[model samples]
Target: MPVITVKLAKGRTVEQKQQFVEVVTNEAVKKLNVKEEWVTVIFDEYERENWASSGELHSLKFGEGFGMKGIEK
Candidate 1:
């Protein structure tokens, strides 16, 4: 079995998540030789204030709307 964990800033639609899961599951099944049922995909979403990079919080660097529509940098 293959377990995949994806972590990202919050604010995505269900359709986006479903599309990602489908693509990831297909790749896992093909590359890892795992059954579709045995492949697990997990998403861990966080707020901009809770995530940071380069010793700076994303909220401070990009405001509270980072990763939202029209604000992905």
Candidate 2:
């Protein structure tokens, strides 16, 4: 069995998460040679304040409502 963990700042919609899971699971099933039922996908969501990069907190760097929308290009 393959256990995949995805960590990201919170605020992604259910649809987005579902889409991500479907794609990731399919990839895992093919690349890892694991059955769909045996593949496990987990999400570890965190607040913007708790997540930091470049020595700056996302909340301060991106500001409010950053979440998934903030990282979009």
Highest lDDT: give the candidate number.
2
* Per-model C-alpha RMSD: 2.0, 2.3
- Give the TM-score (vs. native) of candidate 2: 0.85
Q: lDDT score of model 1? A: 0.84
Q: Against the true structure, candidate 2 has what lDDT?
A: 0.85
How far out, in Å, is residue 39 in model 1?
A: 0.9
Per-residue alpha-carbon lDDT of model 2 for 1-73, expressed as tens digits? 7888999877789999999999999998888888999988899988888988999988887776645566664
Candidate topping TM-score:
1
Instruction: Estimate the TM-score of every prediction.
Output: 0.87, 0.85
Instruction: Indicate the TM-score of model 1.
Output: 0.87
